[model samples]
Target: MEVSPIWSSIVTAAGGLLTGLAGTSGPLWHQRRALARARHAAEHDTTTGLPNRRALTAAVTRTVRRATPFGLVMLDLDGFKAINDTFGHEAGNDLLAEVGTRLAHLGPPVVMAARLSGDEFALLVAGGSDEIAAAAHAAWRAVSHPPVRLGEQAVPLRASVGHTTATLGISPRNLLHQADTAMYQAKQTGGGVHGATEPGPVTDPPPGTRRRDLRHPH
Candidate 1:
């Protein structure tokens, strides 16, 4: 009897289990499964389920090595501290998870999204200068939608977004730094979006400035 292609594939995948149930493939399968689980854990953020910082770096490095046209966007949530302070840390965590959901569905160009610690997030996309900016804007729009409900109150979401396009010689670190600087600029200019066209100083707002600015309802 000739084995069907489907059965053959299944047997091959199962390490010839059909040939012999007591074969020594259990150890190999266990090893492969363990390695896959470990890799997933290493690459994903525990809280938001987005890519972790190390994964982000590896992705950008691959893009740079391939000399691909890529875009990087850095986003920082506005009023995140106040939410934690008022509603508590649990609410803050919930908000971050929701934000991650929105970013992950940004569609097209955006190949990867990552939560880069705290209230900061990053996006890796493929596009030219204008297309990248559009993707960044779309991401910002998605995050800025709907109020994050906490108990009886509905708190409007807001974030500062900044983008940088990769050039032939630019390193991943430099690209991220540039996007971060532009995000800072956006926050300083009343929280919207900005893009880095050149290298320059990116200063943080005064300690109390964010609290004051974000205190009022949107």
Candidate 2:
């Protein structure tokens, strides 16, 4: 009957609408999840799961208040280019992940460990220079242990560290720059021991450095 056909068409239309709505919702849900993952990835290192430089800087700025003894450590993977050129970036990335794992085990005082970029990394420590030095030494020794498993081979990764710590007063950016300089000094010293400030030494702290107190926001 004509009436039956009309009813059938109406039912079919309703069904199609529901099906379309359901189908579209699934993809939308997936898309949202994917977007969240992408955002998370953007702020984190894929291999290490550690925060990148941008995130690290923000965290440092927020955490380094007037009362805390803050320190910064700059780390560079020694012989990283050799590994990447001789082996592959895959191997190099794996090595970085392994290093990150070791660093995480160091626990407190090391508030944050971030992969600045590439084979270079940095740590924000909630302590003075001495604490930073101890931690850097530990991290250095930790990385020097038996080679990591890479493509059926044991890949050795070593680190050179430099640290600048301020218990009373130092800006996070300046602390990092000084720490970077210190790490360079360590690299020049053949990558052993800890706490080398310009190795050849005898220069006084900059004119304004001695006057700054970390305990007060300058």
Candidate 3:
């Protein structure tokens, strides 16, 4: 069959153009995806898949710059070293992942959940003192109950939580320090929740206290 040279030329040109686009676009797409993955890895905890400390610091800085009232809660797992020693590092990793999942599900008021290092974690709550306190207690309940199951073993987790409310003009470092101090206070008296500005009493959850019966400050 005879074909027109003009139409044949147009068809050839179109095919070449389409092939060239695919060749370039494929690599460009892959490069973009790789960059996204790299960014995510940089900002996230490899063990628990939560935001790492660097990301948390950025969030705190942004919140402070906005002059908004918020709360920072720092929590350290009680006896995490023992867990790692007894169950092996794999189990410890599983437990940390479980805790991260629990905290992430705490929903609004808890703006962000981050894993700071080893068994330390932080929560950014969107409110003042009262809201922060409630969020802290809620976080305690989330990790404490429904023991994390690693293989055939059920591991009961306990955390010492300290939280502080922040307003305008507070440095992120100072805010984090306040929460860390409160967490240490809670840790000192076993494990429970404590507030930075509060004094005289700490809400200590008795060992083996049922989740429903655990009392927190009002």
What TM-score goes with each of the models?
A: 0.80, 0.71, 0.82
lDDT (C-alpha, whole model) for all candidates = 0.85, 0.75, 0.87
- Quality of model 1 by C-alpha lDDT: 0.85
- Top candidate, metric TM-score: 3
Model 2 stretches with alpha carbons more than 4 Å out: 1-39, 193-218
Residue 24 C-alpha lDDT in model 2: 100
What TM-score quantifies how close candidate 1 is to the native fold? Answer: 0.80
Model 1: residue 189 alpha-carbon error in angstroms:
1.3
Best by lDDT: 3
lDDT of 2 at 21: 100
lDDT of 1 at 169: 80
Q: How many collisions between residues are there in candidate 2? A: 5
- What would you estimate as the lDDT of candidate 2? 0.75
Tens-digit lDDT string for candidate 3 (103-174): 999998999999998788999999889999999999999989988898998988899999999957889987
Cα deviation at 60, candidate 1, in Å, is: 0.8
User: What are the runs in model 1 whose C-alpha is more than 4 Å off?
Assistant: 1-23, 200-218
In angstroms, the error of model 3 at 159 is: 0.6
| CA shift of 209, model 3, Å | 33
